[model samples]
Target: MTLTRRTLLLGLGAVTLSACADTAPVSSLATTGLPADLRPTPNAAYDAWVASFRSRAEGQGISQSTLNAAFRGTGYLPGVVRRDRNQTEFTRTLEDYLAITASDERISKGRAAFDRHRSTLNAVEARYGVPANIVTAIWGLESFYGERRGDVPVISATSTLAFDGRRGAFFERQLVEALRILQSGDVTPANMTGSWAGAMGHTQFIPTSYQTFAVDFTGDGRRDIWSDDPSDSLASTAAYLSRNGWQSGQSWGREAEDGALQPQPGGPRFAVTRNFRVIKTYNNSDSYAIGVGHLADRIAGGGPLRGSFPPDQFGLTKDDRIELQRRLTARGFDTGGADGVIGNNTRAAITAYQTNEGLAATGDPSPELLRRLGG
Candidate 1:
């Protein structure tokens, strides 16, 4: 999800593989009298990569001065590489995920923040169509309301990931976009800090996403999402959801009144609606969208789910369901959408896919299937 920029919110303790990791900030790079050509990379091999990249950047129309300013003192981040390589996948029931993402503490804080920013939230909603409570819920979830917007230097993180080469082409693209962000003068290198994967600011937008979706709601001439003030960040988040088809006045979802797990007449499944699909654009996990919905509903003075899910059923978390859908989709089996909430479409896709691949046609998605599918 962060790859699409949704994963940027992962790593708030129990939610890492589900999304952003907490990290430190990068140091300033504003030394006076510094010459760009004189900057040296930490490793000789990395230096060679930097040199090779310089030509590619130049071909992309990035000026040497801009490149120099961006890369000065830039080096590989071993920690970034280590974290990326060691990402762990774990399971948590829907209830368990909500316990952490929408805890009472978070809900209380969300209400307080929503009250404090009521006027701004109102104006943003008018312009962008995203409701106040939903925006505040994402705010609380993303960084505890700007308390932790990540600290890893953007350039260092991207450079390290690009140099490490596990997903070199992808990281290299990100690194270039990062350099472009620096060259545009949005923020100085000293100020361009974020997660190791280059997700920056209050809403944790990857550079490309920032370029496409960030807005200067404050009219301050800059889309500043990193400052102590969160107006731009909040507005930008609204913009993201709205542009992605957020329906005004429509709730994300509601729990079944009876907590029934029965299928739609014939088989076991719960078909998600259009709005539920919109929420998935944020994190692509049924649990994430549902968490945001439930948390926002709570912040709006709404009550808890009238029903509950059997935690041990399926032995998979919302994240796992999403991964299964992803694998199924990758193998050319369409599950309609990979929102992690299995429906008739998903079961049929699994059954057909299993049959084609010579596996049991049980129609059940499992860790074993995911392992075989190589997600």
Candidate 2:
């Protein structure tokens, strides 16, 4: 699970927690792109839990009116429960992590997003003392530059997870904070949508983080992170880093030729600076921080890392992997655009090709397999 800004600020351990609800016909929840499992599903136990929770929420100073409005049409989201139960402690190599987070497409989009909102980003930097490119990189990673600010209703998602009770106490606190946000009129329950775990807005600030760092950059009296305008969200992100001691005009760090820190053996080593640690205060992962730094560099017209990563366990270099993917795709086995990342599609393509050729379908790439595929 990836840590939300709230978790980092609160000094809690890292875990992926991500998105929202309400009623008056519940303002018609955005179910169009949401997974079916994320939709409301009847659960007697969950209803009873919410019923009991209303009093605790009230005790926490949540108003009756807010509760009434928030719970309107909200119910158990089975998918939220499933997501809670299914979180695995997995780690990705720095190389692979950058491949996904700072990919060509993400870099391209980040540059365009930065350009499109240059004035706003610069204004945020002026106010917060964090660089524009670093903030933009964060926005790109957190929500694909606002392209995927989640659409699940916040009340519903938080309440459901709170009731699910794996991390019941934690989620209950989040639910309370969400209710408080609604009570304060920051946003309507109907419009308080976010990721399933309730990470909201463009930079995926959890409720507590939002309370601490969100700002009404547009001065419209609302810290509208969810708005399409993105000014508040971007500013809020800069505020987070600035409040946490980001050093303006300092590099997050660079890939050093003699750097001692190498997260993955035989991969490019990085000599991170104080600002790199500051970035980790947003998401406590070396890969995440490095991804932000490297992606920021790329968005600012910098080049790729100077060092190269070593081969994979299969003895295949990135070039070897790319050739494998290209060969497979050329033979009509689509490896999902040949990015050299052996994701499920690429593995499936390898399996299909092997099966068709009466070879074992290991789905693992190898020099032998690459040669067999006419690489």
Candidate 3:
């Protein structure tokens, strides 16, 4: 299963990561829930589990008052189970990946977010030693600049996952942390919402991650990642990166400018610096970090990639795609506009041409095929 890391911190998918090498311990349970202890874990029922958990919380030094409010009206959500079970593996080419993650629209939006919060970002940079653009790139990827932080109630989701017992131990801990967050009064249970796996806030930090890395950057005493202001979330994200050892002047590799654009696994990766490695700590996927880096570069007005990706499973470059499209169009095949993005129409045209040429009609594009087409 793919790990669901909170983007503000590396989505560990319940995987534990300490930006500071250790999650900070909550010293006092917030003074919010029930005044006295609640009864046992509910019998085989999700409600029962929560009840038992409330008692457990009381044992953990949480007050009855905190448990009462935190668990009230909370119940299991089956959708969280479904989401937890599903994880799509990486299959897209780097070009295709960038096309989606760092699309023109996202780049434009990221640039504006960078511009809109220039002073805050600058302060974060000065203090944390992480580049402002890198942090902003992560923001764009995680919640689309806070446009879509998941809407699931964190308590309900964590309790459900905990009760479900698949990753029971992990979820149970998160459930406790969610309660602590409430007890501390950083936010109400209503506002303690996040992804099904419980990654919350602007940067998708899971509950444990929040305790570990979240900071009250607004100086409001609460690290408010969910509020509309986003000062805390933005600052908190920077703090996470900084703690992960983000080198002050490092670049997260780049598209290989070296002519051979083998697109399948992506052209070539620069041997990745310490900062680049730290980016991996967040998502642990090369493509993911690459996407963040490229997108950040684009948002900063950096030029389009100098090298078009090399031959994918289908062979070679933007020019090749357009030329192939043009050639096929000339030969009575409608390959659509010479747009470098080769979707089905282009594939079908190639298949048809191959069949007429007495060749194997695999339908995949190749440089050799382009040469034969005089493209």
- Tell me how far the alpha carbon of residue 287 in candidate 2 is from the true structure, in angstroms, after superposition: 0.5
Backbone N/Cα/C clashes per model: 9, 18, 23
lDDT of 2 at 86: 70
* Model 2 local distance difference test score: 0.81
Highest-TM-score candidate: 2
- For TM-score, candidate 1 versus 3, the one ahead is 3
lDDT string, candidate 2, 63-152, tens digits = 888788778767677877777677665666787788899999999999999999999999999999999999999999988999987787
State which candidate has the highest lDDT.
Answer: 2
Give the worst 10-residue stretch by lDDT in candidate 2: 11-20
Ranking by TM-score: 2, 3, 1
**lDDT, candidates in the order shown:** 0.70, 0.81, 0.70
lDDT: which is higher, 2 or 3? 2
- Per-residue lDDT over 286-316 for candidate 1, one digit per residue giving the tens place of the 0 to 100 score: 7777778779989999986554444336777
Which is the winner by TM-score between candidate 2 and candidate 3? Answer: 2
Model 1 — which ten-residue stretch has the worst lDDT?
12-21
TM-score of 1: 0.71
